[model samples]
Target: MSQFTTPPPLIEDDIVQLSYPAEHILQIKMNRPKAFNAMNNALNAALEDVLNWFESEPTLWVAVLGSTNAKAWCAGMDLKQVNLGAKTMWTRNGFGGMTQRFTRKPLIGAIRGYVLGGGSEMVMNLDISVAGEGATFGFPEVKRGVVILAGGLERLVKLVGHQRACELALTGRNISPQEAKSLGMINYVVPDDQVDAKALEIAKTIASNSPDSVMATLYGIRITDEAGSARSAHRLFVDSAPIKQVHSGENTIIGVRAFAEKKQPKWVASKL
Candidate 1:
């Protein structure tokens, strides 16, 4: 691995970076260190483009979210840009386009330093997250005269409950990685040096699983949440069976094997 500032193979400029391989794991990186990698229009557009590709492209099983600069994963939308009258409907697109409903593939957020406002919201949408030990998380939108319309408040509420969400959103305060983990927001808190490695480890784990089954499991979880009526449940049920078969029974077997082996599981998946 290169320095955090070094561009990845697929990166062209300062906006974003991408790389994909046979493992079916795509890494999407925000590359604007100057503005704390703020959510600018160009970054949003690039993210949207990559997200669309990730969803439509075949054999893609998982995505890992990251930032180039170690100092800040993202400081949220460029408040200066917003203050300067820049157009910003893309904020609705979510951090690096994770909020796009059509792009329902699983994502793992690999966070390092500061993750605030839109950055915070972006992680909220990911299926799992790994934050660096020095990473800090917050909504902080209130301090900037913006509403948490990009799903930060909603997701924060879901993760930590209403009162805690209000406390963070209302104060725009920062929370350490340990606190975030305690609140159940991040899956793991690794050292700064290990952030990307841990994230890729998880992403590889996800990619190793049967792609069809992983997609279905993700779909099933989403459908369960959206199942507001019997009709919706029925539809989900109808759509879910094919997916279950694609899910490798190896996932279960690995769990049992790990327990018996008295060691951490090294999970693997193959194409269905």
Candidate 2:
């Protein structure tokens, strides 16, 4: 059987915490219930560290990101911390300071309460999202005389549609978890008590798969999303040496055979 290992710690204090089990799943908890886990410099830096750890750790295959309390996932950027004059395009950390970090591994968001402004963008970056029944989501930057410069508007448009996204961005409205699910913003909406459990369950399920295939699948999906032309997308994947190696490796062979035989694929985890 393939054994699992834990990733390096990413927390600096009560602001952030990271814990990993022997199932290739990294769980990152935001610890700032006092402020509704507001997005500030300290929290941003902590998130960046966690993302960096995920990118560098080869053993990990999946991540679950959530908040410490059930009242708020994140209340968005701290207005006190926002300096309008310091605006820059696609800053080092795209949205919350962890935006620039890249990883082939997937990020799953477990949202319980309000995921607003900056918080909304953070959740949108994840490949999958699971929210609690009372979860609330919004991008009220427009109400503050500021705009959604963190890629929230654009991403929201892609997530739903231009019309629906425009309504929220223009009106600065908050949508309930059920509405978010209907708009395709979340995958599952469970009871508040089941949020973390469901998120971990999904993460472990993904981690149990062949890591090589998982990475390739993620790469393909992201590349396809960015590709403007079909030819370009095809060339990008075809020229990827890592993808080629994994496709021809024993893991793929076993994964394929397992599927055909209706059995679990016996595989080993390899370093990136």
Candidate 3:
């Protein structure tokens, strides 16, 4: 990764780094260390493309999102770009292209250092998250005369409840990773060096299961929330396509037989 004092081009080779570290896991690293991995217009566009590709890839079942810079996971949108009157800061998928989209596959955020503004919003959208001990999360947009628009406000309220979310959002104060975990914002708080490993462990565990089942499970959970009522949620869960996919798939049969034989199951379903 190259260091650029100025904004880089929005080409595939410049802003983001994509890798497959395990059988079915995609590792996406924000490579703009010089900018604290901030979401400039170009980086935003690049991330949108990468996430779209991740969604379409048949072999990839999970993703671990992280940044190459140790100083900050992301400092949010590039204020420099904003000051320059840039309008391309957002994409079809929203900030960093991942915050607003509904992904069928799961994304696990591996965070460290500063997670502020848009960075915090990205973490809020992750299905699971592992943060380094040094990680600090906040929504400082209020201090900058902005609001948490990229799904953070609502998700924070859901994760930490109304009072806690208001305290964080209105005050523009930062919280340690442990505090975040206590507030139900992240799953684990490990050492900085262990953040990636812990995230990978969780991602691989999900990848080892039936891809269709995993996708369906995620879809079921999200749909229930979207349904917003007991009856509606129950009906959505019962009528879910992923649930039907699991019942009709061979993975269920294989799992039952494997359990009876005291052996690990071989999942044969295609990626969803």
TM-score of predicted model 3? 0.92
| Per-candidate local distance difference test | 0.75, 0.79, 0.84
- Better-scoring candidate (TM-score), 1 or 3: 3
Ten-residue region with minimum lDDT total, candidate 3: 1-10
The C-alpha TM-scores of every prediction are: 0.80, 0.88, 0.92
| Model 2 per-residue lDDT at 46 | 72
* All-Cα superposition RMSD per candidate: 6.1, 3.1, 5.2
**Candidate achieving higher lDDT, 2 or 3:** 3
Specify the highest-TM-score model's number: 3
Q: Which of candidates 1 and 2 is the stronger one according to lDDT? A: 2
Better of 1 and 2 by TM-score: 2
Order by lDDT, highest first = 3, 2, 1
- Model 3, C-alpha of 47: deviation from truth (Å): 1.5
Residue-level lDDT tens digits of model 2 in 1-272? 12335446446676887777546788888888988888777777777767766766766778889988889989987765566543333336666554443447888998999899878877766788999998999989889898887766766887899899999889999998899889988899999999999999999888888888888878877787668877898899878866887977888888889999999887667444
lDDT, residue 228, candidate 1: 81
Q: Clashing residue pairs in candidate 2, if any?
A: none
